[model samples]
Target: MDYERARAEQKLQLQELENIRLEAYKNSRLYKEKVTAVHDKNIKRREFQPGDLIFLYNSRMRLMPGKLRSRWDGLYRIERVEPYGVFHLSHPSSSELIKVNGIRLKLFHSEKMARNQELEIFLLEDPTTADD
Candidate 1:
């Protein structure tokens, strides 16, 4: 009788352990689903239109003029739109224009252009010529 009781206890313990492991896996799957939902909600999609100026990311070939610099270069007009948000930009500096994706471009706003205009005025203004 003692041996039978010991065997029964061992079986119960194994079942308990399996239940605990299944619970842990269920919790982990739930956590992963929640995290993925939050991440998807927070992701933003970018779109561009014609005449919009964009700053191209420097990931092109080494021979490209903007490849050496990482920061924003002068404005380039959007000449054509391609699949998956890719665009073709035209600038006077280059004959072949560049093709870049939406992820590699940042939208330029008029507010930034106004700020640049103000900075240029400040640099070009002569302090002596101004009436104080």
Candidate 2:
């Protein structure tokens, strides 16, 4: 009779452990869903239209030597914008075109500024010191 009571208590403990494990799984799922929602809210949507000037990001920059090497290539004209973040690009000087993911590109907003335009420099005057 003692053996039977001990077996019953063991079974109850096993049942409680299983319930705790299931509750932990449920809590983990809820945490992941909340985290995903927060992450999606901060993501910026990239939009590009055809004929827009944009720079292509070089993915192979780590293999090159320079520490300050620029990762972005010269502005390439968008030939076509496809569904699912695919962009057709072409260099202004070349007729050849290449298709690349939209994530690897950024818009160049230099249309308002002329290529040969010069910037005006302003000089700051030093404060006058009174000599004794």
**lDDT measured at residue 46 in model 1 versus the true structure, 0 to 100:** 73
Candidate 2 backbone clash number = 0
Candidate lDDT (C-alpha), each: 0.79, 0.89
**Top candidate by TM-score:** 2
Candidate 2 structure quality by residue, lDDT tens digits, 55-122: 99998996887765678997899999889999899998899999999999999887655564886756
Query: What TM-score does candidate 2 get on C-alpha atoms?
Result: 0.82
| Candidate 2 residue pairs in clash (backbone atoms < 3 Å) | none
For residue 70, model 2's alpha carbon misses the true position, in angstroms, by: 0.7
Candidate 1 TM-score to native = 0.64
Candidate 2 C-alpha error for residue 69, in Å: 1.8
Cα-based lDDT at residue 111, candidate 1? 76
Q: Which residue runs does candidate 2 get wrong by more than 4 Å?
A: 111-132
